[model samples]
Target: MIKVKVSLRPIVSKINLPTVVKTTILPGDSIESLFIATQVGEIFYIGNGGIRTFLDIRPRIIKLGGSSGGYDERGLLGLAFHPEFYYNGLFYLHYSVAGTQGPVAFSESFKPNPCDPKTLNQRWINRETQYDHIDTVEEWSLQSNGQPQKRRTLLNLRRPFLNHNGVNSLNFSPETGKLVLTTGDGGAAYDPFNLSQDNMEIAGKIIEMDVVKNTFINNPPVVTRFNELPAPIQETLTVMAKGVRNIPGISFQRFYNQYIKYVGNVGQDLVESIFSFVHYKPIPVTQLVQASLMNSEPNQEGFVNFGWRGWEGGFPTSTKGGCSENPTLDEKTIAYYNEAVNTSVSRLKPLTSYFHKDQRPDKFGGTALTGVQAYMGNGIPDLTGSVVFSDLARVEESRSPVRGVLAYTRVRTDGKLNDFSVIETDYNFGSQSAYYVSLGTNLDQTKLYLGVYGSMKVTDCNQGTVFEIVP
Candidate 1:
């Protein structure tokens, strides 16, 4: 059996409003690099492989909105090394820029020149620079060995919303030399026009493209929907999957044929879930909503639809759902109800979900199943192939007796979701909090390095800290 332990370290502390967090060991090198996307700055790179330190890279300022360059939710939000990182000094990044305009028409979206003054958005009228953003993914040149390189945008994104601009989680499927990216819904809140569910637009979809060839998986129709172009712009972009909301972390199984796990942070109202999208299935099926619920009585059977606006984490001030005589007034609640009833039409659900402290924290979010896998491909002592997750404690808010600790379950190779193991981290792990745990290769390698970053207010402080769980 593969034994795993957690190690806690304060890589960085008191850093408020941290976004995308990614970890990658240098290719063919032992240097581990942790990339963090923040709102205050562009991107921050921290190394803990051979040494321990943090490095920040602020890219050249690009005009946003339609004029001069500025920052908002628009900054470097994603970072990834090319599959052949050793060969191509090329790496990819995604950032939003101004100097651009939109709603011009959807089909001919990418046509407006970000530099054109007349084409800028009305919001950029006074900026003297472009108001629209030119978000792109570029390839960079790395130094000899696996050192950081000078970046160049390979693909640019011109998203509608300033927030939910989306981050790129790149993974190379060896089975197919395709690079897969799971992007969040195009905006921070609800997508009214359904840019995410729209098959034509690339804004809110999980896309699959050939990084080796730098092209789309399938050719899509060319027609402008929200751009100023007289005609549609010809483009080659493919959408492999659709309907996802705010996913920052995605990892492929170490075993070639296993499933790909997606750890995402959802917006308020809905529950955040860890999705295991199996690649080899006839249709990639996943499990959602696994957390348990607490009962007011010994056996009270009731259902609580998380009211995003009315009640956050179950306090009930009348924000999200059916609180007033009319529940439809709550936009999020209406959206949730419409979605849940239309399961046939919706692909969104939480394999595991949790309730607020009032509802019950002891039942769900107590523990979840997770793990590190050691594929038997090359045939080594494969000790890393197993399930592991965090155990929940009532540190932050313990309403009733702890029914069960947070337990992360795993679906075995037979495609059965079963209870695996639980981890006890002496922390509250407040509502919707998640941990990104890495079980390194072996003893000679590193065992497990678990770190967490998310919104956790309510304490004396207004912000939260990113911490490593020490075993």
Candidate 2:
């Protein structure tokens, strides 16, 4: 399997460098935190408690300030933490905004009136909340005198692509804790006046909500708003499953003790995925609405169609079947032919893919799988149920076997996806003065006690570093 067409070059060559250490759990105050989505718009919260104490790390922005708040696409993209998050402080975000002045065509439906005027086939829905701010789901609380207690939006999005406001990721359901949203495919390319494969009312899918049903006006015409809050806690978006295309990441795979699994991440343009949310566990929803209203094929149930615009990750549009190795077929398993052409749109065969093709000149911007973390490290004894992934590196080029560092695993408890290793490779570490190595456990057991908060540049400023990954 060595078919060559090589032209990908970006070499500095230095290999094997993993032994970092510069720990900060609450030192000088920095309770380990780092979540970013920055083109610079704003979704910043570097570390340590508020009243502003950023000794330095570049992003401290988190807006909602006057003039009805502002921050266009606003930078910050996605971050999630709330399985119970101790006791519900719940968090979820996705940005990009600045379109109320009105008139911005490309529609099949978008009537909210900015002055109304859109045409991709007619689009201008905003009457105030055609979907509102791409996507927002908040429920914060920490004001014992510590700030941050006024964030309650719980699902809001009306974004028609300023750049795929397909929201990013928010996963929860360690077993019916209920909350899984990975939307995208509501934009980019087409669905133009069709509002994403025949509008089910709101853009491109992968939604499932019920963080404990806030009644949502008793699910009114598909949940509108529950008596404007104060009905217990209010939160409901129950749409369980739907066709996906830009699901940055959504996860859950426990494997022992009553087994629970659901994982997703697909973004076609060269086929990219991780899927196995068991197509919403073995069928039957009136056979997925009689295969979406009186048969049209594509195995209905919960939905998992990884092939968009004819095929990307599964190849075919020809750049040599989208990226080489042609001769008909040579990879085998394309997620079992993207669930048999997403449950019967017919014409199977196209799942297991991992092609590189000179690493990103364009193929919908290279191997996408932005973020995935599931390694509950108490300090890795017998490797305490492993799973670690973060590939936010979108082709800075370097033969991309996943640029920079971090990729680990253990997956097996029936959801099967095996060991495959890389442990951790350096991304600089806390050096530049103050960022240095070895902390927490050791004496023999290999080594483990890693907890690192990220972002570093130093001299020109882009700081914030909390480290430790000893061995």
Candidate 3:
């Protein structure tokens, strides 16, 4: 048996709604690089035990103080460093914004005229009833010693409803130097618009773009609903794969000849899971894959679709059913999804998934399952090959018991994942509330860091925190 013990140790403290965090160490760096994305829309750079403003986009983030109040999904959601960040100083952030104009369309409906409540009941939703947001990816470049300048827009997606827009997660291929991004099927229960299954829309799929060129490495995803949508929007998205659900974080596992990417996807009600996509170079070498050329774009390689909204189980054999957490499962839709599962040409099952069963811990109710990462750091021998992940449960309000999870799975082979287990389950931080949202490897890939969105909030001091998982 592969034995391991997990503990959370504080690294960076007092952050605001800490959501996405990343760390890196280059060959020429004197100090390790630590960067974090806050739900309130600020990316901070920490080093030598201090926090510095890497970039403050708070002014642009759209946070609607409604019935949900401070608890929200809108804000900066993802952060990533260019593969060559050390030399290029380029990075990207995923965030949400209010539409400057009125409602754009049905898929992304909205008219933010709070100043004039008279202009209401415009469309399918009332301005007061729904607060809409547009998810955006902005690229920025940091010079030798100056402010991080916004380079250009990489992705802008329209998000309807309040939550479940999916937790935006971004990472660059260690081997190919390409950007791999996972987006939640557009929000609203049952995916009312059916966007997750629609390939034409980038709303519910995994997309790959050539960040340097700011263009898709390939054409728009050839999804089932290709013919339904307007040709213009169809041509806009560059999908890498389809049938993806809510994925909050992803981690890379690389060997001498193989580059494997793992993404932890959250299920509706019954289960939560982790899936992987692998890319292999034709010729295996001692070193990693050589940055290759592709169809008119840089490093444009393809990946197999890890089926979502339809399929599950490389371990449980095969699991199926409803798309959302909604209790009612449409017979027709369920049948169609089962058919798709049987006939899917490119469906890949999950690495592991935990079901809500009797005798399971209350925390097993994964209202939100966020990150899945294999421990590749050499610092801890026991964790070297272990797959680590996190969960954010909405059912656990700030006061009832504890919140979320930060756990790991044991990988059995080079490809498949079997044992679904937990590393740390006891969570009680006293006046300091403990919740897990983001998981990442710091510089040198030796330590695992967990982003804490909340820990008891004391007067004059906010308890947003980020922690390192030590074995």
TM-scores for the candidates: 0.58, 0.28, 0.75
Clash numbers, per candidate: 68, 33, 2
lDDT (Cα, tens digit) per residue for candidate 1, span 314-405:
22221243335674574322333333343332242233334332234224442222223222222222224433333223224544333223
RMSD of 3: 9.2
Q: Each candidate: what lDDT?
A: 0.39, 0.37, 0.59
Regions of model 1 farther than 4 Å from truth: 1-7, 12-73, 98-134, 145-152, 214-237, 263-267, 280-350, 356-358, 361-407, 412-423, 427-470
* Candidate 2 TM-score over all chains jointly: 0.28
Query: In candidate 1, how many Å is residue 332 off?
Result: 9.4
Which candidate would rank higher by TM-score, 1 or 2? 1
Instruction: Tell me which of candidates 1 and 3 scores higher on TM-score.
Output: 3
Question: What RMSD does model 1 have?
Answer: 13.0
Q: Which stretches of candidate 2 lie over 4 Å from their true place?
A: 1-138, 142-144, 147-168, 171-180, 183-205, 208-235, 240-246, 249-270, 273-338, 341-355, 359-365, 371-391, 394-471
lDDT of 2 at 184: 65
| RMSD in Å for all candidates | 13.0, 22.2, 9.2
Indicate whether candidate 1 or candidate 2 has the larger lDDT: 1
